[model samples]
Structures are given as structure tokens and as C-alpha cells.
Target: MRYLIVILALVMMAAPVYAVDPSEILKDPVLEKRARAISKGLRCVVCQNQSIDDSDAQLARDLRVLVRERLVAGDSDQAVVDYVVSRYGDFVLLRPPVKGATLVLWFGPVVIALIGIIGLVLFFRRQKKYAAEINRDIG
Candidate 1:
């Protein structure tokens, strides 16, 4: 029983995670593949941390439909993505372009890391100075 439970858990963990419903799938395999790829890169506004493809939010579903509609209407993959970005801003993309206001989004972590390193160096230097003072007083 324990082995069966462990196997079940492993299988569940290995399963691919997606929320694509049957009705959302396109008829053309090529289009469907492209749509899926695009969806995987779209951020769900309602669930800010989840991609539209993996989100079950109504907004994600709507975005998925919109993508399909654009594709069917002869929009290129990039055009469909651009359309969504235009309507919702760069935040709609999981990997937003490193331009404009999003330049902060791309570089904020690096800036933060540098700040942390500087702070640590200053803190250690202060601690060492205090230690030296204490040792001189003891001597």
C-alpha cells in the first residue's frame, strides 16, 4: 500500500501541468501548436504570477480565444502577441521586452543584488572595526 501510494505521488508529480480546455484547442495542428506556445508566454492578469496557458481564470480563457481569433484572421504570431500587449500593456507578457518602463523590471534584481553586497561589506567592516577597538581596550 505504501509503495502504491508512493508510485501514485511520483506519477502525479511527473504529469504535465496545463489548463487548456478541449474547446480552446484549434482545429489546425500547426495553429494549435503556435497558439499553445504563445499562451505559455502570456501572463494572466487576473492571476499575476501564472501564465495564461496554466491559469484557469476567465480572463486567461478569453485571452486564449482572442489569440485564436487573431491567428484565424491571418495575424502573425508576433502580431497577435503585439495586439494583446497593446491592449494590456507589457505586463501581459510573461517575458516582457527590456524597453521603456520594463527596463526596471529587467534590471531591478541586479541592482538589488549589488545593494545587498555593498551593505554586507559595510556591515562586516563596521563589525571588524568594533572588534579591533574591543581587543585594544582589553590589551
Candidate 2:
């Protein structure tokens, strides 16, 4: 009975699939594959860190529909991304272009690392100075 209950629990825990409707598939499988690849690179605005293809948020669904619509309309993958970028700006892209306002976003970790190094140097210098003073007094 315990084994049966555990099996039932495991079955219940399976995620309910929200797959795109079968009729929505494009006649060209290649185009659909490209569309999916592009969608996976777009972040869902309503889900901070989840890709649009992975998120179930309303905005993700809307973006998925938009991607499919663009694919059916014969837009290139980049063109579809450019359209969304024009609408929502660079944040929608998983990898935003490194330019202008994004310079800091691209370089922030390096800047932080330099700052940490400088702080450590200064701290060590202060400690060494205090140690020298203590030794001088002891002598």
C-alpha cells in the first residue's frame, strides 16, 4: 500500500505540459527549429531569469506567440529579435549587445574586481603600518 501511494504521489508531481498546440506547427520543420532557438535566447519580461521558451508567464506566452507569428510570416530569426528589441529594448535579449548603456553591464564585474583589489591593497598597507608602529614601541 505504501509503495502504491508513493507511485501515485510521483505521478501527481509530474508537471502539466503546456506544449504549443499541434496545429500551430509550421509546415517547414527547419523554420520551426530556428524559431525555437531564437525564442530560447529571449528572456521573459515577467520572469526575471527564465527564458521565454522556459517560462509559463503571460508575457512569455505572448512572446512565444509573437515568435511563431513572425516565423510564419517569413521573418529571419534576427529580424524577429530586432522587432522585439525595438518594442521592449535590450533587456528582453538573453545576451544584449555590448554598447553605450550596456558597457557597464558588460564590464561591471571587472570594475568590481579592480575595486576589491585596490581595497585589499589599502587595507594591507594600513595593517603593515600599524604593525611597524607596534614593533617600534616594543623595541
Candidate 3:
């Protein structure tokens, strides 16, 4: 029983982790490849942190089907991406473009980190000055 459980666990671990169902795959290998490439660059809106290709969310599945449909309907890779962007906005992209609108998304973390570092430096300096005053009074 233990050996069977171990084998099952190993098989599950070895399985591919992609969310793309076999039914959603395109008949044309080239188009399927292109769809997969595009999917990898798209963010799953529901999962936020996961690419649609890796997310098992219902919204991700819908996005995957939409991408395949667009490809079959003769949309270029860029066009398919644009269509999704038009509907879902830049947040749907895994790597959003660095533009005026997205500047906060790109730099907000750095700005916050700088603020925190400055605050820590100020705090430590204040503590050192306080300690020096105490030492002077004690001596």
C-alpha cells in the first residue's frame, strides 16, 4: 500500500502542470504553438500572480479558449493580444508596458522601499544620539 501511494505521488508530480485542456488545443500545430506563446505572456486576471497558461481558474480557461478562437479566426498574435488588452486593459499582461499610466505599478515598490530605508536611517540616528546623551549624563 505504501509503495502504491509513493508511485501515485511520483506520477502526479511528474505530470505536466499546464492548465490547457486537450479539447482547447488547436488542430494546427503552428497556431497552437503561437497560442501557447501568447498565453504565457498573459496574466490570469482572477489569479493575478499566475499566467493564464499556468492558472487553473475558470477565467483563465475562458481566456485560453478566447485566444485559440482568435487565432482560428485569422487574428495575428499581436491582434489577439490587443483584443484582450482592449477588453481587460494592461493588467492582463504579465509584463505591462512602462508608460505614464503604469508608472506607479513599475516604480511604486522602489519608492516605498526608499521611504522605508530613509525612515530606518533616521530612526537609527535618533537612537544613537539618545544613547550618547544618556552615556554623557551617566559619566
Candidate 4:
């Protein structure tokens, strides 16, 4: 019984888990592959942090179906992505384009870090000046 349980566990762990349902798969292997590729690059709006391909959310399922439908309608991979982005905005893309609108998303962290560093430097410099004055007065 323990060996059987171990084997089952191993099999489950080895299997690739995807949120995509069999019904969502395209009949054309080529189109299915494209749909999967596009799905991986899209963010799940409901989950926010998970890729649509990995999210089990109902909204993710809808997006996956939409992608397959677009591919079946003969939309190119880029066109399908564009259509989704148009409806959902750039936030749907995991790696949103570095454009004027999204520049803040790309660079906001670095800018914040710079501000923190500058503030720290100013704080330390003021502390050092205050300490020097104290020492002079004590001497």
C-alpha cells in the first residue's frame, strides 16, 4: 500500500498541471500551440499575479477560450494578443510594453529606490554634522 501511494504521488508530481481544459484546445495543432504561447504571456485579471495559462480562475478560462476563438477566426498570434489588450488594456500583458503610459510601471521601483537613497544620505550627513558640533562643544 505504501509503495502504491508513493507511485501515485510520483506520477501526480511528474504530470504537468495546466489550467487549460481539454474543451479549450484547438483542433489544429498549430493554432493550439499559438494559443498556448499567447496564453502564457497574458496575466489573469482576477488573479493579478498568475499567468492565464496557470490560473484556474473562471476569468482566466474565459480569456483562454477567447484566445482560442480568435486563433480559429484566423487571427495571427500578435493580432489575438492585440485584440485582448485592446479590450483589457496593457495590464493584461505580463510584460507590458515600455511606452509612455507604462513607463511608470517599468521604472517606478528604481525611481523610488533612488529617492530612498537620497533621503538616507541626507539623513546621515545631518547626523554627522550634529555629532561633530556636540564633540566640539564637549571638548
- Candidate achieving the largest TM-score: 1
* Candidate 3 Cα lDDT to native: 0.95
* Regions more than 4 Å wrong, model 1: 1-17, 111-139
* lDDT top scorer: 3
lDDT (Cα, tens digit) per residue for candidate 1, span 1-139: 9999999999989968579889889999999999999999999999999998999999899999999989989999999999999889888888878887787888999999999999999999999999999999999
For 18-105, candidate 2 gives per-residue lDDT tens digits of: 4454555567899878877988899889876988877878778778888989988988888999999998889899988999888898
Question: Which whole-number lDDT from 0 to 100 does residue 53 have in model 4?
Answer: 95
Which window of ten consecutive residues has the lowest lDDT sum in model 1?
15-24
The superposed Cα distance between candidate 2 and the true structure at residue 101, in angstroms, equals 0.5
Give me the overall lDDT of model 4.
Answer: 0.93
**Model 4, residue pairs in steric clash:** none
Candidate 4 structure quality by residue, lDDT tens digits, 20-98? 9998888899889999999999999999999999999999999999999988988899999999899899989998899
What's model 3's lDDT at 135?
A: 100
lDDT for 20 in candidate 4 is 95
